[model samples]
Target: PNSSKVQAYVLSRKMLDKIVLLASRAQLPLEAIIPEDDVWGDTAGELGNFLLLQRSARGHFRISAFVEHTIAFHRSIRSVTPPLTGVPSSELQMDSLSLELQRSIDYLSAQLRQVQLHQLKVCCDEE
Candidate 1:
């Protein structure tokens, strides 16, 4: 059940070091650095469920899933939403992206058991 399935996140060591270094360079007192995805989830009620997905001509995918109005799963991969080119690499990425998303949905359904997710709300990150 959901009780046994706890939300777990792993931060890359290099990313943390870079964040700390940037804070030091800017002379800013950093008490905590909350992930952008968490902020999106916490403030979702006001915006009616908003997820920021960064898309580019050649870019990676950073996605998250919310359960009970909070992030339950998050992942970043080397491929997602590749441009509409018929290139082999982009095609492979599209295939991988679909597989991963479907697998996640199935896992969530099995874990929650009762709750049904009607829609996955997401928006492109213009930044």
Candidate 2:
């Protein structure tokens, strides 16, 4: 019965085209375009304790969760970290990051409700 069920993934044609073009640019074989979240989740390994944060060139933030090295979920939100203005420190920026982090976590939780995932390890990309 379980073997009879087919697994499907929802993808956008536009994104697939982009992946193809990128592969062409790099002269690499076009195989598949797995989302970054899947990779992050895989790195999480067994124990479900890995998270990743990435900053976009346009000042946005993206987050992903992993459970037992499997993708739990991911989302993109407005920037949490503020731009550096040569100031040594700023409480405002810290507060903003804290609030945004919490909000992102909440969003992730809601998304993961359909599945099971846990842990608290985090990995972030430094720009």
Candidate 3:
């Protein structure tokens, strides 16, 4: 991601319309559409500076940094399964996750000079 990055949330017009229609039929107010990462970032923001490392699925990890009660830096890392293995070993998974997580922290630090990270949180489903 050496190239300059711009963070944006995109929802397809057709899907958004469908959601709105569904809500209207259900008499539910469709106030806003926020990405899941934004919710996580906002939750973490209450803790001041925070770093979240989450496992979304087997061999998949996501990292998020907060900004304006939303996600500032976010990236998903997928670990490769070792040869002849059905899934990545725990150690291999950790290595990939940590390496990407370090790069994310470094990127956030360089981008935001005052990144005084107050907390580090890790969430993974037990195997």
Candidate 4:
């Protein structure tokens, strides 16, 4: 996987550009634009249990999960409906989030089963 491409896709392009511009003005290295969340967090494995959730309009939401101080998954879903006026209704958003959570759990369970099966096969072969 191309990390540069993944970072560009995951982060907002406009925000990255602004960070680059500021770094240039301050005569700082371009690497300054990258976040340092991993440095201290990795030392103590403090980030392993972190689960960040961001809610957006209607059914839109983003969930980031970290495991063993590494981001295991990051997902964002945007609502398909037309833009709403003012804030989106919380009840509706919760419902959407709940549905998505169940779907994610089911998917994860399926993957875990596959991993267990592979491990079992490997163990049997070794014996």
Candidate 5:
């Protein structure tokens, strides 16, 4: 029963754990690091599976896993190229990617707050 919805929920929980870890590293509370109204959605296709996590406001994060149907044949025909012998490049790219991902997470968390605020405003206006 490994349906797409279950997979998405698991992925969302994993992302939440990652956010908590990052928040701990920054000495911030987990609740403070994530917005309360964030939502997770998933779409599965023959080409790939996509996890769309978003807040109601302006931020979202997408993590995709390629479906075997799309890449299996290509990978089968691909040849591995040997790395050139030289001093390996610095870890800057890895670090930069990590930093960028953290920033995106933070931004999305903030958007979650905005989403809550918007909901409150709408409710108040209805009165």
Candidate 6:
């Protein structure tokens, strides 16, 4: 049976992969869809323990739950070192990323709306 940490890791990776696939279909870069911190966490938390998704500034998303687990595990395993540094601030370039992601989602939504509108028009014309 898989450990809780392992399960969490698998779940997190699967979710991230799905997000990437969806973003690609939408013609958006994975970076634009997922925050750098989250990717970093995936790397740091090799055991697949602990994952979190949160919103950053301007509604941009962040992935940071792995860091906490990593730190805790390290402390338990060995002597703790200085806290890892350089977490991106909630405001760090999030506005731009948010705009990009939002643009992609909005474009897709608009396209769908246009198709629906066209279908309605066609049906009305047929009547």
- Top-lDDT candidate index: 3
Residue 31 shift from truth in candidate 3, angstroms: 1.6
TM-score of 6: 0.21
Question: Candidate 2 has which clashing residue pairs, if any?
Answer: none
Off by over 4 Å in 4: 1-18, 27-30, 35-47, 55-60, 80-90, 112-127
What does candidate 3's lDDT look like per residue over 1-127, in tens digits?
A: 2336676778999999999999999999999998877677667535756788766545556777765554567677655332212465667655776688789888888987765665787775443
Quote the lDDT for 52 in model 1: 38
Question: In candidate 3, what residue range of length 10 has the lowest lDDT sum?
Answer: 79-88
RMSD of 3: 4.9
Pairs in clash, predicted candidate 6:
none
The TM-score leader among the candidates is 3
lDDT of 4 by residue, 73-116 (tens): 55665642323224565567556766765565566456433321
lDDT tens readout by residue for model 2, 56-100:
455566666655575555566564553423556577765776676
> What's the CA error at residue 88 for candidate 6, in Å?
3.4
**Ranking 3 against 5 by lDDT, winner:** 3
lDDT of each: 0.62, 0.60, 0.69, 0.46, 0.30, 0.36
Instruction: Name the lDDT of candidate 4.
Output: 0.46
RMSD of 4: 12.6
- Model 5, 1-127: lDDT tens digits are 1123322213377887888888889998655432222211112333232222222222222221122212110011012111211446346633543464455445534533332111101101111
State the weakest 10-residue window (summed lDDT) of model 5. 117-126
What tens digits encode model 1's per-residue C-alpha lDDT throughout 25-82?
A: 9999889977665666776574433233444334566666665556656666564555
Off by over 4 Å in 3: 1-6, 55-59, 80-88, 123-127
Could you tally the backbone clashes for each prediction? 0, 0, 0, 0, 0, 0
**What value does the lDDT take at residue 101 in candidate 4?**
55
User: Which ranges of candidate 1 are over 4 A from the true structure?
Assistant: 1-32, 46-59, 79-81, 84-92
Q: In candidate 6, what are the lDDT values of residues 1-127, reduced to their tens digit?
A: 1124532333477887898888889997665544444454455333443433234333323322232323111111111121112553445344544454445345534533332111100001111
10 residues in a row with least lDDT, candidate 1: 48-57
The candidates, ranked best first by TM-score, are: 3, 2, 1, 4, 5, 6
